[model samples]
Target: QLHNFCSIELGSFYLDIIKDRLYTMPADSIGRRSAQTAMYHLLQALVRWLAPILSFTAEEIWQHAPASDDSIFLQTWYELPELSSAGALNDADWQRIIELRNWVSRELEVVRNKGEIGAALEARVELWLAPADYDLLQKLGEELRFVLITSDAEVYPLTEKPAEVAEEQLGVAIRVVPLEDAKCGRCWHRRADVGQSAEHPQLCGRCITNLGDGEQRHIA
Candidate 1:
């Protein structure tokens, strides 16, 4: 579970929430501020939790971190927040999502082997699954795209099983295609609106909107 917490939970928070969404947004934007606040608190909890295992490193981190206490040892044992506090999906939901994401990765590998796409970010994915799985994925909303790390994704209900898939794993099928959009100079994600703005032609719509005079925040 610790491995899952570090790799899946915290990893997703850093990649999807902080890097993908917050970093792409303007420093002064409400979304960026909100995400930063959440990240700050989460980091404090993580440092305290890790202190038992990595005392010296944790203390070093705590010294530089903004907190009420001077030392991490002064803090109480770390308590995980409620699952709902982190996301709408529960453990089971996340497991299914992970499985689906793995399937996408395998399919992306096939296309990558053909030299059709170099990066996962340069691929568009199509997911075909049973009605139940489709419903679960739909609950993820826009986050599904971020979870897959693709330029675009679409979920469809399975009709007839495709010939390419084995019988046992017929419940899910994935297709990866090279992304058609120009890559955004700022975020490096392929987007259709990359050249829409004359002022920031190299950036996507989101990047252009978030282009502010203030320095962008970096996760140290």
Candidate 2:
């Protein structure tokens, strides 16, 4: 479980997925702030989990972590936040979403191996999803790209699956296409509105907004 939390949750999802938002965006950006806050909790929890197995190392980390003055011996297991009932995506929904995302990754991999795109964000993914999947993804709207880690993503209800792209597991038909737009210098995502700001020629509109009061973000 600890290995899974470290490899999948922290490495794959949190840090790797939103590396750009965490590093490139301004400190005050809501998305950046949200990522930082989540990381703080994760760090604290992980360190506590390590205390029993790696006592010396965990103690070292605890010194630099929050409540540094307190020793790790005094702390109990980190209590994770309970799943919220406030209209947030539950665990099951996220599991389903991960399955669908894996499907999309396979499609992107095929295109990437062919040298059509250098980065995952260099291509856009379009999905013809089952009714359930479409409804779940539509909740994210444009932010779905963040989850897919793609430059752009479009999800449509599956009317009829395409003959070329075959899939049965998730009932998703995926298409990967190279984006022709200029890539954002900061975010490195290809976007058509990249040069809109006169002051920041290489940034996307979202980055521009983030530079000021920060962009509102609910989920990655």
lDDT of 2 by residue, 1-220 (tens): 8989788866886687778678666787777877887888888788888999999999999998865667998988778776568988888888888788888888888898999998899999989888999899998888889899999999877877667866545567888989999999888889999998889999998778777776777777
lDDT for each residue of candidate 1 in 44-144, tens digit (9 for 90 to 100) = 78887789889998999988887556788988866655444454566687778877887888888888989999988898888878998999998866657
The Cα error of candidate 1 at residue 183, in Å, is 0.9
Q: All models: lDDT?
A: 0.75, 0.84
Candidate 1 residue pairs in backbone clash: none
**If scored against the real structure, what TM-score would every candidate get?**
0.81, 0.91
Task: Give me candidate 2's TM-score against the actual structure.
Answer: 0.91
Could you say which candidate leads in lDDT?
2
